[model samples]
Target: MERIVVVGAGQAAGWAVSTLRQEGFTGEIHVVSDENQIFYERPPLSKQVLSKEATYDSLNLFSPEQIDAFSIHLHKPDRATQIDRVSQQVTLESGKVLAYDKLLIATGSRARVPANTWKDIPNVVTLRDVQDCERLAKRLDTAQSVAIVGGGWIGLEIAATARKQGKTVDVFEYAERLCAR
Candidate 1:
């Protein structure tokens, strides 16, 4: 059987697995993710997820039962350290080596926090994951006024959610207009 390994556990990765199954490719499928949490919807992380309008359980893209049904082997909280394309081997941080006939690299992007920034300051946050949203939501409860540094979609979404929660929000955009990049 073909051995397939998918790096990164996100919406796209999940879809790829489903597509493979639909195509009737019966192979060994392995999914590796650095996140310990199960796959969940990303859009709601900055909106409903953070606002308590949605729960983590409700945001899951696939349930444990689904994973079992599909026979997907999930390696959580594990990061891929190196890839030997010539040999078709992937070295993980956990010292596990995965050999694959076909590989998919779906490593997602990270949040861009400015260098020399005052991230240590209280009530300052950037939303990227479920944990981030949860932490930001807690901060919002105690913050009367919040100065959001970006006017991008995430910042704007958080601003809207914060407003709905009755917190005064001031969005700071370095560009001429909001999200004018």
Candidate 2:
């Protein structure tokens, strides 16, 4: 039987798995992710999640029942430390190795945190995943003002949510114009 492994169980990975099954690929489908929560849309993290308009559960791309129905092997809270091309194997942080006839890497992007002391600050937050959004949401609840470093889509989204929450928001962008490419 053919075996396929997907690194990262985010939105893209979820879709890829679903599409594969839909297209009649009958084989072992394995997904490895560092996050406990899998198959969630990131767009709502800044909007609905931050504003308390949407629950955390609402961000899931596929339900637990749906995942089980798809027969997808989801290894949660697990990180793939190495990929040996010669052996066609993926080694996880937990020391388990998954042999894959095909490998798909959809790890997605992260918040580009600058090398600074900001990471040490408790109040300073970055939005990349659900946990980050949750922390920022809690902080925004009591914050009188919000200082956002980036003017990208994520930053602007957070800024918009903060404004709706009646907080003073200042957005600092690297380029002269906001969201400059």
Candidate 3:
């Protein structure tokens, strides 16, 4: 039987799997993700999860039952290092080669943290995924004052979550205004 490989287990990858099943593709389906955990919504990482109002469970895109029903094979805590176009194979970080008749790459972008600065700081955090949300949420819970380096949506959202928890928030934006133009 042929196999379909979907890279990056974010929202797009999750949707791709669902769409494939809904479209009547019966081939073996495989999802590759660098994250060890299962797929979850990213938006919640900055808002609900960071606010401590929601847990990782609340942001899950699909349950184990749903995944089993679709017969989707999940390869996680691993990354696709290279792709062999001629052979249609994906080489994972662990040197495992996944043969696929079709492939989908949905790896999303990451939060850009400036180098030579706050990134090395122990308390500095970025809200991009569930793990990030969990770490920052824990820090915010005991923080009396919070300083957000950016004024983008995620930063503002974090600010709001922090304030909701009764912590003072200071947002630093390089641009004249917050958010993207």
Top candidate (TM-score): 2
lDDT of 3: 0.86
For each candidate, give its TM-score against the true structure: 0.89, 0.95, 0.91
Q: What's the true lDDT of residue 23 in model 1?
A: 89
**39-98: candidate 1 lDDT, tens digit per residue:** 566788888887888887887788788767778888888999999999999999999999
What do the candidate models score in CA lDDT, each in turn? 0.84, 0.90, 0.86
Off by over 4 Å in 1: 116-123
CA RMSD of all predictions: 1.9, 1.3, 1.7
Candidate 2: C-alpha lDDT:
0.90
lDDT of 2 by residue, 1-181 (tens): 9999999988999999989989999999999999989888989888888888999899898888888878988787899999999999999999999999999999998777776787898888989887888789789989999999899888999999999989999998989898887
Name the runs in model 3 displaced over 4 angstroms.
Answer: none
Residue 155 shift from truth in candidate 3, angstroms? 0.6
Candidate 3 lDDT tens digits, 96-127 = 99999999998988888777686889999887
Best by lDDT: 2
What residue pairs clash in candidate 2, if any at all?
none
Which sequence of candidate numbers ranks them by TM-score, best first?
A: 2, 3, 1
